[model samples]
Target chain A: MTNELALAALGDPTRRTIFECLSDRPSAVGELAQLLPVSRPAVSQHLKVLKDAGLVVDQKVGNRRIYRLDPNGIGDLRDYLERFWGCALTTFKMKSEQKGQE
Target chain B: MTNELALAALGDPTRRTIFECLSDRPSAVGELAQLLPVSRPAVSQHLKVLKDAGLVVDQKVGNRRIYRLDPNGIGDLRDYLERFWGCALTTFKMKSEQKGQE
Candidate 1:
């Protein structure tokens, strides 16, 4: 469920940018808003979606909340892709061997 | 461009399902449609989006077109996620060390 949610959460362009920025380092909504074209409230909305998707988590630092990528959620996605990667490689090798046989 | 397009393409549930099926093996539209709830034309439409995103490829096999997941496009997406994984791991180590010092 988290994998599907994470994929849906990242479907939006703004959310992807926010995720990328947070990937670099944690930041508050104001900081993200400053870096992006969108407003602070918009950034907050996107963050909420990411948080709900389990792709992001926030911690209170002083008076502000800092957002960062959740490695666990990312790990789930990575595992999913890794399965496909391995499958593709196996299929490629089999195809090559079959071609050699022919 | 391909990365973003691939992300957007897979963002759709149906397209993701089709991609997953192709991950197992290549199949024609009728074969995919039989396994899916969608119609043959619908499967073709989703395949078109996947192809346009560079996430899927097709070849003429007899009278039918066989579709398969494109390893190159999947590789691009894998590369993108690997970067984030490395960054997250680095941050995790740094934070863990800081906590150890504290």
Candidate 2:
């Protein structure tokens, strides 16, 4: 379920751009907005979705909120994608085995 | 762009369910519909979206179309996620280096 949320959060191109920007460095909403084409409020909205999806985290720093990628969230998403590949390989293995039997 | 499309394609719960079912085994539209709670036409529509995203491929067998996970598509998504992690680590490294210089 959480993994689904992360995927959904990343589905939007704007959000993905915001995520990639954060990947380079943690920044406040205004800084992120200046870097991207979107407004500061838009950045905040996207950050909220990313936070809710567990893909990003924010910390209160000197009256400003700084956002960065959440390692745990990234790990969760990576694990999910890895499991998906594993399942696909397993299906292939089963098919090969069935062919051997035939 | 393709990765974004794939992510958007899987944003829905029903679509995710359909994807998980396909991960288990290749199945015809009728078979997938039977396994899922949705109707056959609905399944077909979902399949179309999945196919467009390059996550699933269909092969015509007799009068039926068998759908299975596309390894290339899965590979592309996995690559994108791995790159994301790499970028994060790079950012951390750069930050550490700057701190060392200071």
Error of 1 at B66 (Å): 0.9
Which predicted model would earn the best DockQ?
Answer: 1
Name the lDDT value of residue B53 in candidate 1: 85
Model 1 - which docking category?
A: medium
Identify the candidate with maximal TM-score.
Answer: 1
Clashes of each: 0, 0
User: lDDT of model 2 at residue A85?
Assistant: 69
Predicted candidate 2 versus true structure: per-residue lDDT over B1-102, tens digit per residue: 777778888787788888888887788999989988889999999999999999999999999999999878877887877786778866666777999999
> Chain B, TM-score, each prediction?
0.87, 0.82
Q: In order, what lDDT does every prediction score?
A: 0.85, 0.86
DockQ comparisons of all candidates to the true complex: 0.57, 0.56
Q: C-alpha displacement of B56 in model 2, angstroms?
A: 0.9
Off by over 4 Å in 1: A97-102, B97-102
Candidate 2 DockQ, CA atoms: 0.56
Query: Tens digit of lDDT per residue, candidate 1, span A1-102?
Result: 777778888788999899889988899999999999989999999999999988899999999999988877787777876774678867877888999999
TM-score of chain A, predicted model 2, versus the true chain A, to 2 decimals: 0.84
